[model samples]
Target chain A: MKARQQKRREGRDSENALIFGDSVRKCKTLGVAKRAQEEMVGFMLVILLVAIIFLIFLGLASMRSKSNVRESAEVSQFLDALMELTTDCRITSFSGSVNPYKTVEELIRDYDRDLTCENGEKARDVLTRTIQEAIETSWVFSPESLYQGYTFEVDQTTGSGASSTQERIVELTWQGNAFSCTHAIGDTKSVFSASSTIKARLILCLSRSE
Target chain B: MAFVLVFTMIFFGIVAVIYTSVSLSNLREQVAELRERQALERARQLTGVPEFAFTPISCSSCIDFDKALALKQVRTYQDFWNIKFLRLEVVYPTPIDKDKECSLSVLPPNCGYVDIIPSPSGNIKTKTAFVDLVFWDKNKGAYVKVLGRVHISAFDVER
Candidate 1:
């Protein structure tokens, strides 16, 4: 009787061990599945962020291109208007009476002439005054913005082109042509005058103030 | 895993659609701008032409209206239609932005029947340029302000 009772006890113990082992295996599988789901969520989030950044970049590039196009058009129009502008600077000489205004493209053309006026004004002095006056009389004149500045330059490109484009610096007032700081030698970018078929080189620079 | 893959595909698809639409709309604006730019170049060259670039001993930056009126080189209404599209408005008395609209093409016989002009017959895009100027009317015996105002038009086609 004692031997039979011992055999029953061992059978019961073996059955309980098998049931626990099966449950342990199921738990391990569930843990692995949960981890994989978490990893997928992270990957999806990363991809979403990357796409958003790319879109923003595209938007910025488009905006930049539009702005560049607008600026170029403004420059073209300004140059055309400048060419169309004429000043009535009729300088009279004693030979008879010369109508110099006809061929004179701009009043600022007198800058190259070394002639002195009877009033003791030098050519350079006249240039300074004429330039100031031209800005006021210009049809396409715009009030200078705080963030933008402009420079007008003239070069003797009768043969080739302006030898150098970068020289001279001058400051201007925020509203218009008022020079914030005065320079004895004004910067010349290039504004050409046409006397007959002769073509002069003219350049204007627009820069961001900042 | 299947859900993740599906969600990713849908998100990327939405992004692509948005990007394409934005680019297409901007593309139209860019084309219109390009046409305007081309017109601007033509206007500049027009001023440099011998007929317009003449300067008498009494004139300065002045365009001769008489010479321009005598331009017989551009004949047919459809032939010189390019010139007809050119607008020259004068803004001397007024501000540049408020330039008066004027074009030699507005003369009788040259300024009618838009359908006959060059186009594939569809919705066309157009832009107007307000070019400022000073003009000398040799016939009218007075100084008139003339500005170049070009109405650049274009029709799109898939290349």
Candidate 2:
């Protein structure tokens, strides 16, 4: 009987030791999985931070490139000078000792009045010819040149405030290259008449070299 | 652990240095652009001076041909402008004699340009802009406005 009791006690001690060993192995496995998950989260965070920084750099670079192109002062001054140029069209009203010649600005104003020049040419036709000649002489648009194309437009607005009606007097476009224009610079000048306002706009399209 | 900390610190230091260098280069470019814009503004201001502008027509962009020719004779204006070179040229109406220079006796149809201040000897680059040139036309018996160009060059002073 004493031997049997001792046998039973030893069996219970061995069983408890085996159960503790199994639990220790399970805990070790769980700890290793938790550590691997933490490492993956840290790596993802690092990658996200790098991506954001790259985007910011790209944005700054694009903005810098955009700022390099701006409105040209030369174009604006050219328009101002072009408007004051005198044409050969002389108004019949101003005759005698001092025959007054109409300037480009004046011709635009007299266009609506259907005025006739001393040479019997219509004011509209004279004005168009003069402007065409001036533009052709001034700008040389070619693929090799800085400018690829150009557009000159004139608009006349009649009446004041909200009742004003805007009409296009003339639009001239010249393209000298098959290459696509990368940029454009332009300016506008306004001439006030007795009953209307005339606005002249000149836009030059630039090639890649510009 | 100590080694990792040192490596991280060194990496960040390199990044910071690169960022600073890039920023400094961009600032230098901006400074150069500003200088160019300032020079252009100074050139434009030349037209606004009373000595060059056409006062009778009250046109801001018009330069009186008579005034420009007369200004060439005055020696005092040379020191006042402090520029290396100045010139006014009629580009349109296709002057009959392109090479002929304008004087009091020889006018527009006979001459193409007037040298208000002749070019000084140097490698200085010229800046030019379009302007309206108004002159009295004896044949037409009225004032005529022609397309003109103004050329200017500044003296090279070390900044």
Candidate 3:
């Protein structure tokens, strides 16, 4: 009679709360629930990891883009200013009298417009001075500065009637660090009438400041 | 529930602070950079002014100041460049070093400054250049070392 009464109590307990009871089906259900919860946590962690990595990469790309824009603006303005400068070099071939002051742009524009001096030697001094000044004023690549190095080149593509093209480059004032390297290029083209066009390219490389 | 709420608030607060700091720093850097560019542009444009200009239509390095026409030209520049304050000081003849804030208002035009506009007050953006100036000074009777210094002050930034 006592054993029969104990069995009835056990049945009552299992019916009331199957989740915490010693019922066979209920135990299996609890095991599955626990495993599902673990998997859900793992998935959530993976999602979080991916989101963090994506955000970091996106931020890095944005910084790089902003840096490039700044460098591009600097280079473009610098080149424009440099080209507008007047040189002591004379371009008196076209006009009757000797006009002592002619800018780089003027010289390039009138390169093929019946110049008495076919060789670019007359304007070499002006080109050299302009390039030297540009280099001197430019940022030097270092741990402190955002700029690494720069190369300013002017290629007299069509105007050079000589044997070859007239290509000139400014002396490099800076060298980049090993880790971070960047380059920004700004171009200027001058076309006079229909004869010849002068193309000039300015490149600025930047480094991530430490 | 209260604990969870407090923890979330703290996390978000930290994130907000961090985000704001980064944004503010970037903004400050950009503003500083813009100020520099503004000064550079103004200086370049000064080269284009015929009164302060030489041979080339626009030459940044060669600035020749004409005493007769400088004041009028400077006023035109004040309008063109939206300049608040413009000061051009020249030191003619190295040995003499005849340097002083020349009052263009004074008669006989003894002052060094064109004095088109009065000096601007408050925050200003300034750029100086050691450029070549071809000035004919009757007193000196020669083209000496006339250094051109241009100081430009833009409007005050409200923020």
Candidate achieving the largest lDDT: 2
Give candidate 1's chain B TM-score: 0.48
**True-structure lDDT of candidate 1:** 0.44
lDDT of 3 at B19: 72
lDDT of each: 0.44, 0.77, 0.52
Query: TM-score for chain A of every candidate model?
Result: 0.44, 0.68, 0.49
Candidate 3 residue A115 C-alpha distance from true site, Å = 6.7
lDDT of 2 by residue, B1-159 (tens): 344446556656776788899889979867765665566566666678989888776676788898889999998888787887888887777678978999877777678999898877776677777788888888887888888788788774213
Comparing 2 and 3 on TM-score, the stronger one:
2
Q: For residue B106, what is the lDDT in candidate 1?
A: 37
User: By DockQ thresholds, what CAPRI class is model 2?
Assistant: acceptable
lDDT of 1 by residue, A1-210 (tens): 889999999888899888988889989999989989897887768686967898698788878754221235534454444444433333444233233332223434444455454455554444444434444333233435322323444344333345434322222232333233221112222454453122322222233311
Q: Of the candidates shown, which would achieve the greatest TM-score relative to the real structure?
A: 2
**What is the clash tally of candidate 1?**
13
What is the descending DockQ order?
2, 3, 1
C-alpha lDDT of residue A108 in model 3: 56
Q: Against the true structure, what is each candidate's TM-score?
A: 0.51, 0.76, 0.53
What is the alpha-carbon lDDT of model 3 when measured against the actual structure? 0.52
